[model samples]
Target: MCVISGTHGVEGFCGSGAQIALLEDAAVIAAVEKYGVAVMFYHALNPYGFSYCARTNEDNIDLNRNFRDFSRPLPVNAAYREVHDFMVPSTWPPTPENEARIGAYLSTRGEAALQAAVSGGQCDCADGLFYGGAAPAWSNGVFRDMLRRHAASRRRFAWIDFHTGLGPYGHAEKIHSGPNDAAMIARARAWYGIDVTSFHDGSSTSAVLTGVNYEAPLEECPGVECTGIALEYGTLSLLETLQALRGDAWLRNHPDADAKTRAAIKRRCRDAFYCDADDWKAMVYDQARDACLQAITQLAAAPVPH
Candidate 1:
């Protein structure tokens, strides 16, 4: 299964290009056919955001952050409320005073606070960026439905999710999924080696992530052996990307702002997660192809887990 990040269209230069390359690779296609592994590619899971160049979907929900069980009281990030207004200010191209306020807040609050306040998914505001929906998202529902239908026939399933804007340019990090299940970790190590990092260890760039994308299959597809990896590629540094996102959020919130200001904000957001140059595209594609091929080979060789 292909789980690609940055499917939010603007980040397409990262994993989107790589995903297409893998799909086109002659050897990769042959391997899939040989192993009888069905390919499920989730393209632009956040189509609205991708098409509009925003990280959050039309609902302003980060697809990755929207996977919580709606039945439960959603996870709350209290710190976000304080900076929500600052992120999506009422006026476009935030007034110099507003910018100074945000700078001062960041200075006093620290970078960690800024990251947490911005990245920590929220449920209270629909217009706020990175809002983790109060209920299951459209993409979330679609993915679960697909798993229910296809997972029943497959005994072994492996997933590689594509992502960007972490690490050095073109560098890929393998972040393991779910709890540190020993057998699962062993299987992943056997395929990708010792570099596999986890959220529990604080090594992964991904915040302590949750949702059904990884956990749901483990629970629902008890009959199938599943292991997943989020292949995060490097584009730009975190601080720069954060600034870009902040700028984008500000512009999105302030629609009445000048066209020039909005255009610049949108451009910054696009550049933060994607590398538009052909050389960078080639590099990301090559690495992604290698990783997917390795997974396919390992799956073909390993004995079916009982």
Candidate 2:
């Protein structure tokens, strides 16, 4: 079993915290060992983003979107092209005229279109939101290597990647990330419970994305039947999360901004991704513990594939 968190950098605080908390818990460890499961913990996949409290990496690549096969044609997002300028303007906070322009676009295009355009992972713009890098990022290479080394021998693999910023506050949404076959879906639902949602089924809070991190394992270890889920915990509302992301991007673009402005942007980024409350942390830990245990139990019963 592999558990990962902090793939989004600034969003890493919640996941990293949960990983640390879970790892330290004797019960969690005992349960995994009892089930004869080997657990690999990956914390802060994007160290730069985690350290700087930004969403993207040193090159401003969204690590979650940087997992595509670069030898082939990159996935295009025409919708993202339509709203790129409006989303990230020349000025921070956006001018009133720009805001009006965005409002007009949203009124015409609708929220779903906006969500798909912004969050669907674009390869055209290197500096824009959810930009899948032109080439494999450092994190991508590291993760691929880790999969080959650690998971290649395993016949069945189960993963739970922790994330934040896209659901009801404090709720954990189990998102299916592997193949959408009925059997696979059934198995995931059985293990994680019926609350699981699949991106293919249009039931997930997330938009259909390209170059997601979870696909890396399948690409690296084709011999293994890899099953993965993104345990997305909610912090703020969608609009608020977008605002915070935009604010952080603006700060990145304008690094010379005053300390107060920078601090405020950082604070917004944190609030957008992390609840910073005891109750919220408790919910995160409980959900993670339950999910991990479920995966361990199911994998233990299944025979290892040859």
Candidate 3:
């Protein structure tokens, strides 16, 4: 079992908590022993973002979107180019005109179109949101190395990557994290259940994103039967979370801004991703535990390990 936390940096608040809980739980420990499952817990895969309370590393690269076979031609997000100016905007708090432009675009092009344009992977905009880096990042190489060392020879691997800031509050939307391969996606559904959604099929709340880090495992652990899903929990409304993200990006670009504005943006950015409530925490941890147990059960039940 491969469990990853902090892929988005700030989302690690919820994910890290869940990981700690799993580590301390006697039930979890018993299951691991019973199944003889090898568990690799990657904590804070993007440490800089986790430590600094930002979503990206020092270079402002979204680690979630930073992994890819960079030798190939990058995927072009032309729609991102169309909306980049307003989405990233020239100023914080976005001018009324900028906000209106988004509304108008959404009204005409629809919200899903706007989401795909804004959140789908893009490499041209260095400082923009969801920018897939032009090349593999340092952490990208480190992750691949970890996979090579730990998972390269595994016969059957199951991964659960924890994420936040999407879906209804406290709901763990199991998003198929692997590619569009029918077999892998089916395995994910079989293990995690049918509710596991896929962006490739437009069943996921997320956009069809590329440069996702899962490619690292597929490449590093070739021929291993793998099933992966991102357990995404909601914290805030999409617009609210998006606004927080814009402010965060703006703050990254403008370090000379006033302390008050900087503090406010930081607060909102954290709030958009992490809910500091007991109820929400319990919900997140319980769901995470349940997901881990489900994966463990499947791992134990596999008829013939390859």
Candidate 4:
């Protein structure tokens, strides 16, 4: 029921499907009521991120990375440590020094290594954006409560969290859930069809990470057989997206940066994630709607597996 969009601010384009067409699909609605399926659509999990055109929430926490128990031991993203400085630069966009450093790192480590290092969430840096919070965020609490309320009576659950900025442009990558139960995998393929890929198999476009929006429900609703999918649409190159994030993060941390510079950075970040063209928007909306309807129908109509 969590239609996750706006994990990155510019990715709001992906939210159009969940908010509008998917909710309107007649087949989806019929399937839901006909099979007694209850739903709770938590759209735009990171509203501040959506509005501000940044990936993280208002507290500078990546909503996806903020779900764990922050009071005790916080999970460390070791790879993130390697690229943290580059991600949240102390100065503005690509200073000559930074450009040289980043160029060197890319040359030595290669593109995927740079991506995996910087894109992964980090802790211990509250000032830098995308810092996973020390504890459960307000959104996390709301989601958990909602899951408990809506799913307590159900014996099965399915989730499709929408995303953008990976893989081929306009293609929707159906990323499999993290848990590896046989029945869960079967249910996902049936719902999303056979195109879905699991992280365990190394076929998925999504990188392996911890503390996602999906993992919470699985842990909380032990009674219900829960499965999750990330409907990842593509908008730009991964390098471009990462660069946008870098610039945006730099602007956020350095308040002394001029307004013009800040505005330019924001624009780049938004453009990198969202397509402003009318045709592009229309296409994204249509695909998202189709995906949602298919998910709703499959989840609602399918009989529980024994």
Candidate 5:
């Protein structure tokens, strides 16, 4: 079982915390020993994002959306292109007209359509939100190397990649992380329970994303029975989180901005993904432990490979 943190950089606070908590968790420790479950806690998949409190890497690549075969034709998101100008406007705080354009789009297309358009992993927009890079990132290659070195030997592998800035505050949405494979989704639901939701079927808060980090395991650990989810913990409302992301993008584009503006945008970016409250951390740790335990149990129960 792989418990990955920092797929989104700033969101690593909660995910890294949960990893520490799980490491010290008596039940988890006991289960690992009893079942011989190899729990690999990989931290800070995107160190640059984690350090800078930004969602994307230094290259503005969303690392979560950066894991794909770049040789194939990438998915074009014309919708993201349509909204790009307003989404990251000329100003720090978007003008009323810019927001009005977004509001108008939301009103006409509905929230789901807007989300799918905006966050469905756009390859065309290097400067836009959720931009999957035109080529494999250095981190992507390193991650695959880790999988081949440590995880390829396992017959049954389960992964939980932690994320933030979506859904109700403090709720951990277990989003099916692999491809739209029925058998894989069933295994996830069976291991993690019915709460496991899939974007492929519109059952998840996330859009139908491509180039997700989970794809790494499928490619790297070929033929392994893998089950995974992006445990997206909600920190703030979607709109607020989005505004934070915009502020981040704007900051990245404008290094000459004032110190106060820079600080405020960084704070906004961190706050959007990481709630510092004790109660919220407690909730996150609890859900994370539960998810890890579930995977451990399933991994233990599976028959040993011949």
Candidate 6:
């Protein structure tokens, strides 16, 4: 079993904290070991983004979107293209006119459409939102390598990657990421309960994403039966989260901004992805522990392959 947190840089702190909390819990560690599950924790996959409070890596690439088969044609986001200029204007906070233009697009296209356009991983417009890089990113290579080294020998593997910013406050959405076959879906439901969702069916709070990190195992360890889920916990409203993302993009573009602006942007980003309440943290830990335990139990029950 493997758990990954902080795959998106700034959006990862809550996940990172949850990972640490799980490791420190004696009961969780004992339970995992008793099930004969080897648990691997990947904290802060994009260290540069984690440290700088930025969503992208040092190359301004969205680490989550950077995992793609570069040999093929990259995915396109025509909807994002329509609003690209408005989303990241030259000015910080955007001028009133630019903001109005964005508001108009959102009003016209509706929220889901806007989300698909902006958040659905774009290969074009590297300077724009959710840009998937032209080549595999550093984190992409590292993650693939980690899977090859640690997961190749395992007959059955289960991964729970932690994320935030796309659901009701403190609610954890278990999103399955591998084959959408009935058996696979049933297995996920049996392990994580019926609350599990799939992007293929548009049941997830998240739009259908490309180049997601969970695909790494399928490429690196083809023989293993890999079942992966992204436990996306929510903190802020969808619109608020998008605003924070745009604010961070603006900050990235304008690095020479004043301290006040930077601090405010960072605070918004944090609040958008993390709820700084004791109850919220408790929910994160509870859900993470439950998911990990469930995965381990399921993996232990499965027959080991020769």
Q: Could you give candidate 3's per-residue lDDT for residues 1-306 as a string of tens digits?
A: 889998888899988999999999999999999989999899998888888789888788888888877788888889999988888877887899999998999889997898888788789999999888888888898999999999988888888999999899989999999889998888888888899999999999999998888888888998887788999999998889888989998998899999999999989989999999999999999999999999999988876644
Across residues 220-267, which tens digit of lDDT does each residue of candidate 5 receive?
Answer: 898788889888998888878888988988889889999999999999
TM-score of 1: 0.88
Please write out the lDDT profile of model 6 over residues 220-277, one tens digit for every residue: 8978988889899998888888888888888887889999999999988878888889
Give per-residue lDDT, candidate 5, residue 235: 87
For model 2, residues 1-306, the per-residue Cα lDDT tens digits are 998877999888888888888878898889888888899998889999999988899998998888877899987899899888878777876799988987898799877788889999998887689888899899989988999999988889999998999998889999997766777777789888898999878999899988888778888888787778999999988878987888887888888999999999999998899998999999999999899888888898876766
- On lDDT, the stronger of 1 and 4 is 1
TM-score of 6: 0.96
Cα lDDT listed for each candidate = 0.74, 0.87, 0.89, 0.73, 0.89, 0.86
Q: Estimate each model's TM-score.
A: 0.88, 0.97, 0.97, 0.90, 0.97, 0.96
Q: What is the lDDT of residue 17 in candidate 1?
A: 69
Q: Which stretches of candidate 6 lie over 4 Å from their true place?
A: none
Pick the winner on TM-score between candidates 4 and 5: 5
Please identify model 3 stretches exceeding 4 Å from their true place.
none
Clashes within 3 Å, all models in order: 4, 0, 0, 1, 0, 0
| Model 1: lowest-lDDT 10 consecutive positions | 1-10
Candidate 1 per-residue lDDT over residues 165-232, each given as its tens digit: 77788777888866767788777777887888876677776666554357656765777878788777
lDDT of 2 at 199: 87
What lDDT would candidate 1 get against the real structure?
0.74
**Against the true structure, what is every candidate's RMSD?**
2.5, 1.2, 1.1, 2.3, 1.2, 1.3
